[model samples]
Target: MSLVSKFATVGGATLISRIFGFGREMLMASALGVGPVADAFNLAFRFPNLFRRLFAEGAFNAAFIPLFARALEEDGEEGAKRFASEIFSTLFSVLVVLTALAMIFMPALVTTIIAPGLAVCVDDPAAGGNALSCAMRFEITVTFSRIMFPYLACMSLMAMVCGILNAYRRFFAAAAAPTLLNFILIGVISYALWIEADKATIGFLMSWGVLVAGIAQLAMVTLAMRLAGFSVALKRPRWTKGLKRLLVLAGPAALIGGITQINLFVGQAIASFKPGAVSILQYADRPYQLPLGMVGVAIGVVLLPELARSLKAGRLAEAQHTQNRSLEFALFLTVPAAVALFIIPEPIIRVIYERGAFDPSATPAVAAVLGIYALGLPAFVMMKVFSPGYFAREDTKSPMIVTLVSAGINIVLSLVLFPILAEQGIAWATTLSGWLNAVLLFLGLWRKGLWEIDGKLVKRSLLVLVSALLMGGALIAMMWELNAWLQPGDAVTTQIAAIAILVAVAMAIYFALTLLTGAADRTMVMRLVKRKRG
Candidate 1:
């Protein structure tokens, strides 16, 4: 499949996952609000998610895909399946051990990881509370997190197989696996609330739900793999030469790949302060990520296989063309979305949140985070586009180094700005860190003679902005008109209807401008359709 088409397939499925994810969060807001339970839930949730990104999305895929693709090249389907089984068995054992140890020692782990801001206020709210303070109790968050943290192990195993599946061009099952997590959590949370309304102590039920959901998630993906003809069995841990090689590549790649996520940790650590800060940032980030996750992550996943195949086939020119096109496409989609989000965060936030537990007072803090994050939107998307160049070569160290450098910048900025920006400072740190990572990667690639851009593609990328700018003007006007039409704390139906109209108008204007600026060329539109279908 072409890069665009592949991106569309994964991205379309991811878009569904993200939307369901939004619904899940909305339910969470109504159930937990920004209370201690919400804070604990946020921190506890980050534990599994952090590793899901670190091991599954970052390190495992960086190492696994290139080698898996190579096996497919040399040995075809059977050989590739065998290789994946071996990797799966080995990864499964390691994750089991890791999850066991983590659950056993989760309190200290939570204490160690949460920011002083959160942990401090979390302990004693009367005495200004500790940063890690939970609305329930510090132990409550820690205990709940222990139950849920096994998800890292489950998801890691699932992600590794998904990488193998992706190499086999089975994108839907792997991408769709995440939807199970959202749905399961949603159902679990709803039932927990319905049955135990009096002591909704949201954290207790929600945490339990996450653990059950993780199990179901692992089962779903494993079944999908079995149906796809993958086979596996338990075995003693033994590192073969291939596994060793993957370790070498994955170690740095994991570090580099985890930079974006690590930045979040830094932000979260800092955000634990000022009550509701963590939840505020989380909610604001929802809309901002709608485009990023759908486009950025989708492009990155597709680009890895696309470039790895090209490199294996000795098609350097095709690889270069693919890289350039991916970058252009990233710019085309991400830039406009960034502009729109940065300019109109409050309207978007008010539309989606600000009901039940989530109120209007929460809007600015979330909007602040959203706008700050917007500044790095293009860079974050392009980072995905560029990093695949190295992963395809089984070279993870360079990107790892680049990520460390960016992370260093993040740590520094967080300390300097945390006191000043307070809740939003953490958001600023993430934005700065993403751009830093992107810049370093681009410079490294150019210096190493890894990629070059086409002049015409650059011009085409510029046109994306022109139409986006025009659309932005129209959106600004609509948001102003809509503000008068709807109130923040209004009924869910009214808010939903207003948001629907706003999105429809913005999309219509954006689409109209795209046609005018020729952004939707016949070829690109066709490419987008196939991509979505996949």
Candidate 2:
């Protein structure tokens, strides 16, 4: 299959998952709003999610895929399976211990890292609010976190299996697995709402749903692995040469892979000082995550394996072209997405989240956060594109160093800005830090002569930006023209239709401009589609 076609397979699945994710978030917004229970649930989920991203998706995949590809190239499927089994046994043992300890110390983890602000509000009289309420929220967060912590083990194992699948060019099951989480959550929330459950009850139900979803996701991917004629048997964990090397690379790749999550961790910690801030930022995050997951994630997943195979086969030019095209594809989609979000964040947020307990008053804050996040959207995607260049070469250290610097900057900025602009400040800090990470990754690849900016890429990138801006301008005019129909008080169907019209118009303009100006390669896209069909 062609590279773009592979990307489409993953991207298409991710798009479905993200759509369901939107449904989950929208339900949560109605059920919990930005209240204390919402804060508690979001904080609790973020805790395990943070670790899941760092260990499972980020570090494990970055360190594992290249080595797996090499094993397949050199020693065939048997060698790869042996390597995977060893790592699986070791990872399972470590995760068991980690999850056990984490649950045992759940309160400390909640108070210290997950939501320190809640702890302070509870203990410090000077901080002065409802201490009883704060303590309750704190306990709820701890309980919810403990319930969801086991999810980390499930997802981490799933990610390893998915890495194996991706290396084998089996993208659908892995890409589609995330939808199970959203599906389960949507059902849980729907039931909670149907029964008129209170906020605390809803939160508990959702946490348990997360654990169940993780298990389901793992089972789905594992079944896919077996069906693909690959299996990793349980074995005694050992310190083999391959295991030692994976650990060495994974340690650095953890930091490099989870930079975005790390920044979110920092932002969440800081935002916890204020009630509703965490939920607000999260609500804002969902809209942008759609594009990032569909485009950036698909590119990252597809590109890393492609680059590894190319480089392993001693095809430097093919690797370069892969990186360049991935970058082009990421920017082409994300730049326009960023433009749309920046232009119409309020309408989007309102349509998605303004009903039920989600007050109309909260729209402006969420919209502001979404707009700032939109500014960083392309950077986030670019980081995904460029980091694969380093990882495919089995060099995780360079990106690790870059990620650390970017994360540090994010910390400093968040600390400085949160006091001033509230959640929007955290949004800005994340955006700036993201751009820095993307730029450094690209420069690192270029300096090492691993990647070169071809003229086509350069030209196409500028034109993509121009097309996106033109779309943004048209959106601005449309918003003004349709102000009455897009209002919060308008009928839900009317508001949705208005947003839909705006999006349809925006897509039409952006695609037309890209096609007419040659920013997007129509012939290449057509050939990819035909090849996939063939």
TM-scores across all candidates? 0.93, 0.98
What does candidate 2's lDDT look like per residue over 1-534, in tens digits?
A: 888889899999999999999999999999999989999988988888888889889987799999999989998999999999999999999999999999999989988999888889988947966878888889899999999999999999999999999999999999999999999999999999999999999999999999999999999999999999999988999999999999888998988888888999889988999999999999999998999999988998999999899988888898888888888999999999999999889988988998888999999999999999999999999988888888887898889999999999999999999999999999999999999999999889889888888999999999999999999999999999999998778998999999999999999999999999999998996776797899
Global Cα lDDT for candidate 2: 0.92
How does candidate 1 fare on TM-score?
A: 0.93
User: Once all C-alphas are superposed, what RMSD does model 1 give against the true structure?
Assistant: 2.8
Model 2 clash pairs are none
Q: How many clashing pairs per prediction, in order?
A: 22, 0
1-534 per-residue lDDT for model 1 (tens digits): 666778889999989999998888878877777766777778788878888888788987788899988888999888876677677778888888888888887767776786455445555556585434344546766777887888788778878877867776778777777888789778877886787663235677777777777777778777877888775666665777768888888888777777777888777777776667778877777787789889987887788888999999999999999998888878877887887888777766776666677766877778788898998999889899888888998878788888888898898888788889886788888898899899889998889999887785767777888877887888778777877556666666776677678667877887777667766565768776797899
Relative to the unseen true structure, what is the Cα RMSD of model 2?
1.3
lDDT of 1 at 466: 84
